[model samples]
Target: MRVAMIGQKGLPAAYGGVERHVEELSTRLAKRGIEVTVYNRRWFSDYQKKTFQGIRVVTTPTLHTKHFDTITHTLTSTIHALITHHDIIHFHGVGPSLLSWIPRIFSPHTVVITTFHCIDRKHKKWGGFARIMLRLGEWSTCRFAHKIIAVSKTIAAYALAVYDCTAIYIPNGINPVKPITNSEQIIQNQFGLTHNNYVAVVTRLIPHKGIHHLITAFTGLNTKKKLVIVGGGHFTDLYVKRLHELTHGDKRIIFTGFQSGAALHALYEHAALVVQPSELEGLSISLLEAMNYGRPLLASDIDENREALSDYGWYFKSGNSADLARQLKKLLATPRITLERRAKIGQVYVNNLFNWDTITSDTLHLYEKLVAVKPGKKRRAVAAAFRLAK
Candidate 1:
């Protein structure tokens, strides 16, 4: 089957959960003998590359502004997919799903599948107008797509409650990494980090991620352990600047802007503790990666984090730097053996629950089922169902 993937930043997946999801899913689909074409924004991907990991890469231009980047690029991608003769045009995230109706209306022969990555409007990055549009995008996703996938149970329940629609619940998957032998060397060379002497956070610098809260909490505490942040800003330059400003005089805090490959694996593998203080998430890939590395975790007490971690790690009151500091101090004081044991158990639990092979097979089965349906009949059935839903 020929498929076109839209809405992710691009593949070699430097950052972002959606990018990682698309990269892994598309590569697996390609291995299964399905032809996959990923639509990438020119800014995020190398325009010269024709393919990534055997999947076709189609780079298109976007407006590059924070508001226009995703929507404009998705618009162009949708139009490109319409003329590309793809059997399935899959859109990721609510923002890109807003344009799902375009394929539904203009190219009825193509099946439209949308995955709700998160309730993006909740993120502080969006303005009032963008938030309204994202809300409408959620509406359009429910009404226009042939199938919807939710990355978390929380997201699935939200879709059902708000839209009266049942979406397929498919959580994100994680691949196990080989143990980095030179972890200490890698950390020392990159960020002057000593093995088991740092708390690591791997996420894009954004308001919703709550890195500011973490910075505040970490700096308040008098500890020798370094707080190493392992990501860069997307379009939030001001926010990133503020984060740096927060740690201006603190030598213990390190901002290693976007590490991947061995360096990233080393950071996770050798960390004393991994922290995720995000206020909102749709199944964090970073959290899962941390678990895979068998690192003890500390996260904000948000429903999404609780859903993923589920008593496997320590938690603190959301957005409360004092509570975070308290939790951090307590966890830091705990014996290393206890933390490693907890991390090992959590790793085994997550490995069994979230396997990429199973997720890829399930997704492929869904695609095959959708492809087998007669186009005209499928359209009528969807239209009728949508009307009844209204």
Candidate 2:
């Protein structure tokens, strides 16, 4: 069956987890002989209609506004998809949900399936109108979708609690494991990393990410090691400028900005330990990626992270730099092999629970169920009647 995957950004997966999810899921689905098309914002002058790995990448006109980017993209994408008339339209994030009302009008034959990536209003990054937009978007999307996919049980519960809708809990997925070869030597030379020289935190540089807390905790640790921060954001330069002042040229804390492809894997492979200090998360793909590399994780104690890691990860009090520091020191004192063992356990947990193949197949099953209807049933007519009555 033909499927159109609409997202805030188009696929080559430059940054976020949702984009990565689309890239992996769509490509795998394509390999399985399912036709897939992904919609992306037209960012570069070089960008044009193209196919990347069997999935069609359709560029739609978008507004590069501070917060209205999604709304603009959704509007254009709605028009684009209606013209294409794809069999199923699977949307990622609540951004597109703002226009969820349009699917019934624009593409009636297409089934709308939405994946709730996170409870956006609760995000620390959102403010004022942005927060209000999120609430409205959530309500509209939840009401419109034939089926809603939640990334975790916690996320699913949040959706039901907020919207009172039936949502399927389908967590994010990662690819199979392949050991990193010469990862340590390569990263060491590239970033001037030394043996047990730092604690690594991989996350976008945002206030809610709790990076400041990690840095504060690391500074007070009485150790001579560095805190290697890997990630860049639109707000990155602002945060980095402030962070440099906070670190006071200590030179122990290094900000490596963003790394992708082989560089990302190499950093994860060689890090002494990986820390996820997010104030909020819905089953972080970063944590799962760390697990895939068999890296020990020190994550904030939150329901989502706890649910993902179970007892396999080391926990620190959320937003408490002191507690985090203590936890880090304790772990640093342990054998490297001990960390390795924890990582192995974490890997087992992810492989069993978070593989993309299982997730995609389960998602396809949900779609089949959603689209499936008895020949005699007049679902569209009934839906039309209800809409007219409303």
Candidate 3:
């Protein structure tokens, strides 16, 4: 089936979980013989439309501002979608949801599905006006879309509680990567990370990500384990500077910026344990990758993380540095388990739950149901599908 996958940022997945999700899912779907067109905002003056992994990458015009960029891109992409006859239009994020109104208004025959990754207003980056616009978009889209995909049961519960919509739960999936090149020594030398002597925290440097708490916790830990922070922020100077000041010039906590490819793989391989200290998450892809690599996880106690990891890793109180430090110390004090056992369990969890094949099959099943129904009558179609599932 022909599908249009819309994301705020274009594919090739520069950053963010949704972008990565689109990239991996689209590639896998294409291999399964589904035609996928991904719409991405052209960030650079020289950005050109290209194809990657048999998926068509369409670069559309967008306002580069934080508030208007998504809206502008959605409007333009809506125009594109309306003109292009596709079996379904799958939108990621609330930005595209603003234009969900358009498809119903114009081309009611096209199946429009959306996955609300996070509650927009609750995000720390948004301002008052931006938050209002986002909530408005969410209301408009969720009220009209054919189906809603929530990444976690927590998010699904939030959707029902807040939006009063019953969304299907389809958690994020990750492409597994086995350790390839041995670049640990090179990365260590470049970033000054000691071999096997540091804990790694990989996430965007956002307030809600709880990096500040992680740093504070790391500083108080009794053991000699250092903290290696990986990732960049939209407000890089503000957060990077704040994180540095919080650490107080102690070189124990190192910000290695954004590392990907072999370097990132190497870091994960040599990490004592991978920590995700986000205050909130909709099933973190990073945590999944860490688990796939078989590194024990030390994450904030949140519903989604708990749901994802369960007993596979250790959890600490969210945003509580003292509690986090205590947990880290306790884990450090405990003796290490056999690597083979840890790796085996991790692989099983990923293969059973987070594999792309399973996720894509479920996605296509939803798409088929959406496509079978006539346009402007989505609620009935959704009702029928739920009934059929039961």
Candidate 4:
């Protein structure tokens, strides 16, 4: 089967969850003898090659602005997919799913699938207009897409409650990180961090990620250990600037702008604790990576984070800096032996639950089922009617 994946930045997957999802899922699908084409934004993917890891990478131009980048590229991609011969057109994220109706209208025969990554409208990054559009996108996804995959049970429940749509619950999966023996000095020399000497946060420096809250909480506490923030902003320049200002006087607070591969693996491996104080998430890849690396976790008490980690890690009140500070202090004071024990248990839990092979198999099964079941005449008629109405 030929599948066109739209709405992610690009492959190689340096940062974003959507990019990682596309990269992993598409490569696995290609290995299964399925033809997969990923639509990429020009800015995110610097690769001049058309193919990577057996999957076709098609780059499209977009207005590289924060608001326009995703939508413009998705618009162009959807138009391109309409003309191409593909069995399925899979869209990721709600922002791009807003245009799912375009494919439904133009190519009624092709199966359209969308994955609900999160309640993006709730994110602090979007303005009022963008949030409203995201809501409409959610609505479009529910009404137009042939099938929907929710990355978490919380997201699935939300879709069922809000849109009256039942979506398949397929949690994001993680690959196990082999322990690095040679990279210990890389962390020490570059970031002045030693094993178990600092707390690390691996996420974008956005308001919704609650990095500011973490900074506030970390600074209020009395500790010699450093706080390492390990991600860069996509379009959140003002928030990034504010983060720098918040850490201006504090030399203990380190900002390592977007480290991946061995360097990122080392950060997770050596850290005393990995904290994800995100106010919103749809099964964080970073959290899973930390767990895979056997790092003890402390996250916000949101449903998504709770569902992801269960009883394996610590939790603080969401958006409460004081509560986070208290939690941080409590975790720091805990015995190192206890922390390591919990980290081992968390690693086993992730290995059992979030296996990438399982995720790949399930996704492929869904695609096959959708392809085998032909669209009903009534459904096609309805789609044609909607096109005429438009």
Candidate 5:
């Protein structure tokens, strides 16, 4: 069956959770002999290649602004997707799913699927109007999709509570990691990092990610170990600058600006501990990656992270820099043997619980159900109709 995957920044997946999610899922779907065409925003995708890893890449034009980028791309991509009359059109991110109704009405026979990746409205990064639109996007996703996939149980429960829609609980997953050994030393030579001598967080440098809190906590910590922030901002320049200002010239704090591939693996492997300071998340890919690499963690005690890691590692009160400092100091004081043992358990847990292969199979099963529907018959979207008449 043919599918059009929309609403992510183009694939080769340099960064961003949504981009990575689409990249991993689409490649696996393609390998299974399914025809998948991924919509790419020309500006976000670095390369001009029309295909990657057997999946068709169709780049569409967008406004490329802070607000309009996602919506504009989703609008044009949805319109463009109609021409192909795909068997299924899968939309990622609620913001892009704002326009999902276009396909629902335009191509009545094509099943529309939306994944509730996160509650985008809760993030402080969005402006007032953007937040309101995101709220409606949430409703659009719940109402327009023939099926909805929630990346974490926390999100699934939230959707059920707020919208009274039971979204499928399909968490973000991790591939089996290849632990970096032999001291490649990219981080070491450039940043002077060594085995078990640094704390790392791989995320987008946006306000909601809570990097400022991490910097505040790390600056006051007594440990000699370094703090490595491995990500770049997404239209949050003021917050990124504020992060640097908060560091106050602490040489121990290093901003490595979005490392991936072997450099990413090196940092993950040698890190003393990986910390996720986000105030909100939809089962963080970085969190899963850290666990898959067998690294112990200290994460914000939000329900989502708790659901993701269970009792795997330490937790700090969300948004509390002082509490985070206290926790950081305490975790650092623990013996290396104890930390390594915890890391080993986390590694095994993530590999078994969040395996990408199983996630792929589960997603394909969902696709099969919709694809098997009798021709000329349209499965009604399960949620209540939107209150608005368009």
Candidate 6:
């Protein structure tokens, strides 16, 4: 089957959960002998290559602004996919799924799949107008697409409650990493970080991510452990500056901008505790990776985080700096051996649950099931699929 992926920024994922999700799924599907084509936005991609890991990468043009970039790219990508006659066109984000109607209207024969990766309208980065459009995008994704995949259980329940759409619950998967050891010098020399002495949180610097709250919480703690925030902005410059202001020129706070590869793994390896303080998430790749590395975790108690963590690690009240400070103090005071023991148990648990191969098989099962149906029977097929999934 020839499949096309839209909405993610590009391949060779440096950051972003959607990018990593697309890359993992596409590569696995390609290996299984399915022809996969991933459309990359020109503004976000620096990759000059035509392909990666057996999957085709097509760089499509976009408007390059924060508001217009995703929607514009999806429109052009849908058009190109229609012309090229792909068997399935899969749209990733709610923002880009705004254009799913183009494919549904123009070419009724093609199978259109949309993944509700997150509720993008709730993010603080977008303005009022953008949020309105994003809300519309959510509506578009739910009603226009033949199949909808929600990344978290809460998201699926949300679809049923709000849109009355029975979105199939498919959580994000994590690949096991060989945790980098004996890299104390590599981390210390680059970022003044020492092994098992610094608190780490890997997240994009944005308003909704709650980095400011983390900074406030970290400062209140009496521990000598440093705070390391790893990631860059998603068109939120002023918010990033505000994060710096919240630090108040504290030398203990380290901002490592957009790390990947061995360096990132090293950070995860050496962290005493990994925190995911985001106010909201569909399903966090960062949260899963921390578990993948078997780092003792401390996450905000958002329903999404609770859904993923589930007695796996420590939790604090979401967006409450005082409670976060208290949780950190308590966890920091605990013995290292105890923390490692719990983290290791959590690691084993997550490995058995969220395997990438299993996720790929489940996804392919749905794809083949839908693609087998007759073209004119889309409405009946879609209803049946939804019923079966629910």
How high is the CA lDDT of each candidate model?
Answer: 0.90, 0.80, 0.80, 0.90, 0.88, 0.89
Tell me the tens digit of each residue's lDDT in model 1 across 146-169.
Answer: 899999999999999999978998
TM-score of 2: 0.93
Total backbone clashes of model 6? 0
Q: Residue 71 of candidate 6: its Cα lDDT?
A: 83
Which model scores highest in TM-score? 4
What is the alpha-carbon lDDT for the whole of candidate 6? Answer: 0.89
TM-score per candidate, in order?
0.96, 0.93, 0.91, 0.97, 0.96, 0.95
Itemize residue pairs with steric clashes in candidate 4.
Answer: none
Q: Which ten-residue region of model 1 has the weakest summed lDDT?
A: 380-389
- Order the candidates by TM-score, highest first: 4, 1, 5, 6, 2, 3
Task: Compare candidates 4 and 6 on lDDT and give the better one.
Answer: 4
- How well is each residue in 1-390 modelled by candidate 6, as lDDT tens digits? 999999999988989999999999999999999999999877676888999999999988788888778888888888898999998999998898888877666666788899999998999888899999998888888878889999999999988999999998878989988746557777988998888989999999988898888999999888899999999998888898998998989989999999998889899989999999999899999999999899999999999998888888999998999999999999999999999998999999889888889999989998998899735555655554446336
Candidate 3 residue-wise lDDT, 280-384, digit = tens: 787898899888888878888899898888778888989899999898887777667753366458757876799877888888888888787767565655554
The per-candidate count of clashes, in order, stands at 0, 0, 0, 0, 0, 0
Off by over 4 Å in 5: 180-182, 374-390
Q: Write candidate 4's Cα lDDT for 1-390 as tens digits.
A: 999999999988989888888888999999999999999888886788999999998887789997888899999999888788788999999999999977676676789999999899999999999999999899888888889999999999999999899999988999977666778898998888898889999998888999999999998888999999999997899999999888768988999999988898889889999999999999998898888888989999999999989999999999999999999999999999998898899999999999888999999999999999855565774766487446
Per-residue lDDT of candidate 5, residues 10-29 (tens digit) = 98999999889999999999
lDDT ranking, high to low: 4, 1, 6, 5, 2, 3
Winner on TM-score between 1 and 3 is: 1
Which residue pairs come into collision in candidate 2? none
Cα lDDT of candidate 4 equals: 0.90
**Segments in model 2 whose C-alpha atoms lie over 4 Å from true places:** 44-49, 235-237, 374-390
- lDDT string, candidate 2, 1-390, tens digits: 788888648767877878888888899889888888888887622456489899988888888865867788878887788788777788888877877666665556678888888877777767788989988878866787777888989988888887788789989888876766777777788898865567788888877788888988887777777789998765356776776777867778888887787778778877788999998887799988888878889999988899888888799999999999899999988898888887898888888899999988998787677667411234673476357436
Which prediction has more favorable lDDT, 3 or 5?
5
Runs of candidate 3 exceeding 4 Å displacement: 44-49, 338-344, 376-390
4 or 5: which has the higher lDDT?
4
